[model samples]
Target: MRNLTQTVTRWAPTGTDAAGDPIGYTRTEILGRWEESQQLFTRSDGTEAVSRAIVYLASDVAVGDFLLQGSSVSASPPSTAWRVEAFRKVENLRGTDSERRAML
Candidate 1:
């Protein structure tokens, strides 16, 4: 039921600074099914988080990645960024990887 296209931005560690701090991120455009939902889930860090939206896609996205509402590719990022709180891969009935679901 993929019906939406959004932008997924992830932090890409190009290199470390003088203090050994990671920096920089590049935006990625991905088409997925976006749905507004109210679900509670446990994060990978064992923290409780409430998801306001969910996105289903074929590509994988990390927990901290950002998800834009629409297919927006601009020089400057959008102000309304939804941070991914949880992510998991779903399998088909045949046990093959079908899609990845992200909670934001």
Candidate 2:
């Protein structure tokens, strides 16, 4: 296991309302290794996105959802919410699943 130093708050997607506004979110706290990096990844829509941070955890994260700094996750999320652009399961050199990675 990695030495996870940060707590990341995830806002799981709940379907929007008829008005196109977000109805609600299922929030979860993830303890993970957070790193600030510049990386390119493909979105679900086949578009390229530059990720500002990468989070490694043992839990699964959904693409199209939102992530926030744990300290900044309050009643209302911060304006700089990072939308989950991609997700990948990392494997170790032994060909075993290691961790879940989220590109934000």
Candidate 3:
């Protein structure tokens, strides 16, 4: 993780309303520490994907949850969001304090 930290708002699904429509994710939103990087990830099926950013929090998250982040520029109000496509966890190391990596 990098020292350049940013705020992340995670929106999780709550439930539905009267007409079987999706309701609020207000109570489901969670804030976390996020960092931006330029790392590419490889999948089990031999496919490659790029992750625009990363979340450093340890809380669990599901697919389709919204990830909100403020723009990098200081004087700009533009922000971006992404859906959780998938996540991967890797473990094992020779000599390092960190032994695991969680990629999304």
TM-score: which candidate is best?
Answer: 2
TM per model?
0.74, 0.79, 0.49
**Sort by lDDT, top down from the best:** 2, 1, 3
Instruction: Using lDDT as the measure, name the better of candidate 1 and candidate 2.
Output: 2
lDDT of each: 0.71, 0.79, 0.51
Candidate 1 structure quality by residue, lDDT tens digits, 1-104:
34545545443345557987545556667768778998898899899988898888758887666777666565434567677889998778988557789898
Q: Stretches of candidate 3 above 4 Å error?
A: 1-7, 14-31, 43-46, 70-79, 89-104
Error of 1 at 9 (Å): 6.5
Model 2: how large is the Cα RMSD against the reference? Answer: 2.3
Clashes of each: 0, 0, 0
Index of the highest-lDDT prediction: 2
User: Residues 47-78, candidate 2, lDDT per residue (tens digit)?
Assistant: 99898998887688888778876654454345
TM-score of 2: 0.79
lDDT string for model 3 (2-72, tens) is 43255556655576688865465532334456657657876556777777766654345665455666433
After best superposition, candidate 1 residue 16: deviation in angstroms? 7.1
Model 2 residue 25 CA deviation (Å) reads 0.6
**Clash pairs (backbone) in predicted model 3:** none
